[model samples]
Target: MATAHTHVTKQQAPPHRAAELSAFGVLILLAGAFLPIMDFFITNVALPSIDTSLHASAASLQLVIAGYGVAYAALLVLGGRLGDSYGRRRLFLIALVGFVLASLACGLAPGVGVLIAARIVQGATAALLVPQVLATFHHALEGERKARALGLYGATSGIAAVVGQLVGGLLVGADIAGTSWRPIFLVNVPIGLVVLLVAARIVPGTRSEHPVGVDVPGTVLFAATLVTLLVPLTEGHSLGWPWWTWVLLALAVILGAVTYGVEKRAERRGEVPLLPPSLLRLPSMSRGLVMVLAFSIGFGAFMFVFALTVQDGLHADALHGGLAILPMALLFFAGSVVAPRLLSRFGRAAMSAGAVLQLAGLAWLVAVLLADWPHVYLWAMAAPMALAGAGQSVLFAGLFRSVLADVPAHLGGIGSGALITLQQSGLALGVATLGTVYIGLAPHGASHAFAAVEYVHMGIVALLAVGVAALPRFTRATPVTPVTES
Candidate 1:
């Protein structure tokens, strides 16, 4: 018996050590994830300053936001494929360097055109950087460690948007030697440099065992499809709904069909497509992706509209606008930290509960706004915002887990890419669609516009709650031990 126990211990020791990702290493990976998302929202609060400093038109400002989002969404799958074929750590380091360079260009840009171009490049590099974080988590950790790491990732994502607004407000308000909006982009420099340096020493290298080459035709079609779809949605209203915008929207649908057909044919021919059709066939992946899209749309709309309402409607400064959302950010982090425990106990029902909580919070917020109208204090909205934040964090963590749970390890990069692409696209769409509505109605009354948007948010969350009921119950299973590379 003693000899058997000793033999088993010897066999288990190496795998145990191999599975360990140091706390610092995990932090570095999470930072990489945080920067890209934060950059997206940071610019929201800085737009006014940018307009003043650069003398940019409303259309140009919209382009600045759209360019980054379109590039990021279009290239994400390619980034994932590159990481799988090349090396995740190598790609991550390279992308981080590129992101920092692009940030510098944005900060130093003398004209609106240059800023737009730089933002696009920044978004492209971000595509390369973000997927690697999720791939690493999938490849390097498992069991309880994996669950906790994912929870932290969810927390990081949820908080980064609010932090972006807060940090952007602070930096812009500071005027940092009269630099105005420039510091928002420049802020990424030192942080990226430090993370890049530490990541080189700590992050384990990983890649697919049977890596495939890039699918050229599929890449072009996919890029074109997303450009047609996203460009119009993001820029249409700002540009006064031109004929070209409608044309592009129509083209997007046709191109989307072609892309799907092309991908299906490639799969049938035993060729690797940019997006593997087989991956979407998994019930969990498909259902979870739909949930992610719905949830993200509401989240995106809320952030954008709330910022505008507080600043433009309430006539609050950028600093005060950011402060108003601080409670939500704090509660979101708290909920995310405890998500793993919640999941272990309540399973899929936890997601349902979260959605209900979010709906309740939204309803409360709407009621408060209706009562106070133009005089509503920011603090009056804090409790509901905190409740909504906690609920969102819980649902976000659950959806992330469900989406990736059944994805084969070899396809982790693509899966992560797909998940994030939908998320980013949904966010952009939210800003475009509901943002247009709010802008149109604002001329009548800010309070009415705000309440209408919140009502839409409530409807979205209600749909999510209903969708959660359809998800299959979670079944406890033994965790797979992943093999990590150095």
Candidate 2:
């Protein structure tokens, strides 16, 4: 249920906009929230340049991306829980400040070592800032206003996925002020500084009266599990399949098992486990999370593979490659905008439809690849790309609501964090497994190699469609998780 009118007036609603504050305050809050997601995609296009300029290896480059994602997924829950315990506004400001400092450190990094360190620290601070976005909106808005806020937030994510490419390509290709790839990191400075100042004035502070204490042990254990699991997945290929890679992978599994035991013990003792056991108990929530992991892995690997196929295999320049993805980008925005409406009507059926469409598109795409491996062009690929893009956008909105629908307010942060962690682990795995397979299969020409890679991905995407179809039938737009007193 939406909050009482009295609570909304007291807690979050600003009197007016211009005439009063209105929901514009919440809008400003979302702008600050969007930066980190944008940063993730933006960095991918810039990675080749970063590698060449800084003498970073393929392994180190993967680390730059993986390290941020690992830290982000691991600590995101803690960041959200802190907002619940302390205050959302206070943490937002502090996290914003940390993000700025970290951005500056990344921009100024002289060597590969410094850049990687800054990226990890930057990811950590982003964990703190982003959780506050959804929590703040939840605390502050109600009814139609709340739905609009969340829909818009998800839309921003959709837009960022596209904009990251445009911005990364333009800036990196500009070689602006002769900064080369450095401009990509440097550009965040102005944007971050401005958002910080504006947010201080507009966003409201809100926290639940009753909140769980931070689970310190759970945080450490979870972080360790993610780092151990993700590090080798991202770096192992470069190390020539070392024995340590297998060792670390096994250890990550063990650490994750131990972490669950610790959380179970804490729950038994009537303490807030790092992740509340009840979270996993919700069958829909469980399925939604698995969907998040599967979806993100396939999504992450698809983008990475496409970039290599276009640029390295086809000999397209950065600008040309970025422009080629524009059709998908445009339809993605369109799909996200229309999805909230579909959710209100068709419900989880919308998700099923999205999956079927994506599978059709991927299957069509595979046919084109196998038949015209040496002669494919952007024009030939546009149809499947656009359909897949729209289908994917719809899929994410459905997934987001499904994951959080039954989440208790106290543990919303953890639930969201856990979803992201599973998402990232899946993403890292996709890149490692799918990427390794594609690279291994394409032992000859760049064109044939790229063709083989897409064929594999089409099959993977088809598998993901089956999983999405399996999502609990009730997850139409949003399945209501029964609020429990536990």
| lDDT of model number 1 | 0.77
Best-matching candidate per lDDT? 1
**Across residues 350-401, which tens digit of lDDT does each residue of candidate 2 receive?**
8778877776776666667667766778677789878888888887778877
* Global fold similarity of model 1 (TM-score): 0.89
Per-model TM against the reference: 0.89, 0.88
Superposed on all Cα atoms, the candidates' RMSDs to the truth, in angstroms, are 6.4, 5.1
Q: CA lDDT, every prediction?
A: 0.77, 0.71
Backbone clashes, each candidate: 0, 8
Q: List the residue pairs that clash in candidate 1.
A: none
Give residue 277's lDDT in candidate 1 (0 to 100).
Answer: 76
